[model samples]
Target: MKVVVRVKLLPSPEQAEALQATLHACNRAANAASGVAFTTGATHKFALQQHVYAALKVKFGLSAQPAVRVIGKVADAYTTRTAHLDKGLLGHKGSKRRARSEATPIRFRPDSAQPFDDRCLSWQLDARTVSIWTTRGRMKNLAFTGSPDQLKALAEHHQGESDLIVQDGMWFVSATCEVPEKPLNTEPTGFTGVDLGIVEIATTSTGQRHAGRILNRYRRRQNRLRAKLQKKNTKSTKRVLKRLRRRESRRARDVNHMISKSIVERAERTGHGIALEDLKGIRGRARQAKRNRYTLHSWSFAQLRDFLTYKARRAGVPVVVVDPAYSSQSCSECDHTSRRNRPSQAVFACTGCGVVMHADTNASRNLARRGEIVWNAGRSVSRPCPSL
Candidate 1:
């Protein structure tokens, strides 16, 4: 498993200036490289590097490694842009959005993140400082700080490149760590079905519910404040808006971590696997009212699912994703599938079996049952051997 550990970089005034200049120069070089790639159709890393590598070192004051990294970054951005375009994420064919995207080369922001490999960036974990290459020259003894767990992970498993990111005038290095995964648990007592929703956030088949009411209330307040700030359009208000950019998201992320930890711990203790709903294209397929659209888009169900997956993996608990087509509408008691089963959002009353329960709980039970069937099918290998 790969994890990113972010630590704050505490640089002095002069060091900060050098870091800032380095970022600007790297991004400028990336922009130039992007233009060359667009015109010559040399989007591959080595192909683009052949065109702009020397120029980056000469004109942008980048060293050999920084210049190479800049070219690689440009190549990656174009690859991602091309992929998104191919996937119809920008827009449909002949649409204005697609046309505009196709017409121009990609560009990078001046303060965009720049990656540094071991050659250009060396960590001094014990000293809590880093020696990094800069446009101004090699800078050393740059102080950094992180939580104990983060520092430990960096010292133990940190590998590969680290991104130098500047946000809200604060510098950070997001270092990648490769953590070993535990062996899979082949025999689980049962599967715990988790049904995700906007209102309840997550509900287990065992009747445990994590409500999203508090988080939703917080987001609404933040939205109102953001609207007022946008209406004012003053310099101070803009600063405040910048400061508050990720407050709501940070809160949501913390909440997700807590909820996922609780659920995974309980499952591990009970020797049960996790079963999640496969909601891959829900955003594109589902419709929402005007008033509910914001809530639908703002909720981070995907993030929660990711948390659950990684935690379960580390804990050696198995996980399965089941089809959720009629999980809510189907009765968990008598296997009766009907739209009338869910007459209300919170209440589930089966017309066939006359069983009453919470709608989310019922859906979760159906998912759990389906997950067991899938697990059992995977375990069976009773087919005749092929003749060789």
Candidate 2:
């Protein structure tokens, strides 16, 4: 299986400048290719390559591989926008009318990672440095470091593209690495259902809670800071806002990673499958009562789910995703479904069974039971089941 391992990249100021120029040049080539791709219906990577490869190299000073990579970048952008319709869902025909053939001139995002080839990129463990091809020429011996564990991974088992990216004024090399696939997880011996929510990052059927108090508290503080910064409308304020945004994102990502790792470890230790709600489009579909929308809307349920998946797989624990509908309202004890049963966000008292429990925990228990059922039936966990 392929996994992306992101590591810090410390480059000389001159190297950074060269890298930025290469990014701009390639993005310019990509925009030019995007326009032609849409017009000529050359959206496929191979076709886009055929149409733009020669011009990209000549017009943008991109070498052969980098020029081809530009076409891939545009193709990916187009592919991402069409992925929803490409899933081959039952009985769904594609749109009868096509989008405007005219492609918008796409600008390269500063955060865009330049793809690397073995010829273009190399790493040296002895020096803790990276060598990368840049616009001016090949840049050798740029310094980098990461956590000891990350450095260890870089030194061992690193594979695929180590694309260079810049974030919040720091450079990073995101590399795809190979991991040995665990034998398909055995049938679940038991299940631990996890309910992901805003107030609590996660609540398990076993009654363990990963609280969101710190996360929510931090976000509230961030919002206040951003509000004050936005009122000024000055360059310095803009810079502060950008920095604040990066800090909050990093904080949330770290917390979710910790929570997911803990949850997966717990399941592995207990020899149980981890059950999670099918949370696709959760932000768009779910509604929080008045005054709670901001808190619910911004939380990272999706990221937590993804982290749980990979971690659970690595530990040889099955991850079962079950239907999310009525998960919060349904009573796990009695199988009763009612909105009234859940009196508030935190408490659940089932009218049918008279069983009282933490609302999120009850939901998690329901998810856990549903997951076991799905696993026993030997079905894929991704598809949503309405009655589970």
Candidate 3:
């Protein structure tokens, strides 16, 4: 399994200046490469390298490896964007079309793309520093640190390349490492259905609830604070607003980690496979209903599910995703699907069987049933469920 841990860097003044300069050079080279790629319709890495590589090294003061990395970054950027663009406009992004898509002009922003491989960047766990290939030369043994847990991972499981990121005027390296997954040996006890939502973070078929009310309250307070800050329009206020946004995001992420950890731990202890609703792209699918749109539009279902998945994989736990359609509206007791079954956000009353339950809990039970069907149909095969 691959996990990324961010470590804070404590570089000397000279090292910091060099760091900024190297990144600035990379930015200029990437933008130049993006321009050349768009103009000559050479979005492929080899074609881009042939067209602009030598010039980038000489002009931007970048080394051979950084120059190659810059062109590769630009090519990746265009490749990602071209997926959403019309096929006919794949190689014609530079053309003057009647109405151009957002992907038409492939431009790179300052400090947008910087990638380093083993050749350009190396980790020094013993010295608690890193060596980065720079314009001058390799910036060797630049001091850095992180939490003990993160540092332990760096010392133990460090495997892949790391990204140098500057956010909120701080330098940090996001280190990716490959770690062996935890071994779990347990027979199947049953299946636990999990319902993910905005109201509460999760509701399990076993009647467990992880509330997200605190996070919601915090977001509301921040929204009000931001609105008040925007009225001033001063430089300090803008900075404060930006810091506020980052702080709120960190809080949400921390909460998600805690909730996901608890959920996975419970499933592991109970020896049950987890069943979850397939809610990918749920934000785009939600209606623009005035009161609910803000919360729905910003739901973090994807983050929670991702956390669950990695944790489950590490523990050798089973995770199954069932179709979300009618999972909430269908009665778990009678198997009757109805729009009226869920009359309110929190209540679920089956008209046919007249079984009362929490809306999310009922949905979770339905998911559990789906998982049972999958397990029965193919006990020998691990991929029993029709994955979403």
Q: What lDDT would each prediction earn against the true structure?
A: 0.94, 0.82, 0.84
Best by TM-score: 1
Q: CA lDDT of 164 in candidate 1?
A: 97
lDDT of 1 by residue, 193-244 (tens): 9999989999999878999999999999999999999999999999999999
**Pairs clashing within candidate 3:** none
Per-residue lDDT of model 2, residues 182-260, tens digit only: 6656865699999988788899998789999989999998988888899999999998788776788789999999999
Alpha-carbon shift of residue 221 in model 3 (angstroms): 0.4
User: Number of clashing pairs, model 1?
Assistant: 0
Query: For residue 74, what is the lDDT in candidate 1?
Result: 91
lDDT-superior candidate, 1 or 3: 1
Residue ranges of candidate 3 with Cα displaced over 4 Å: 86-105, 182-187, 375-388
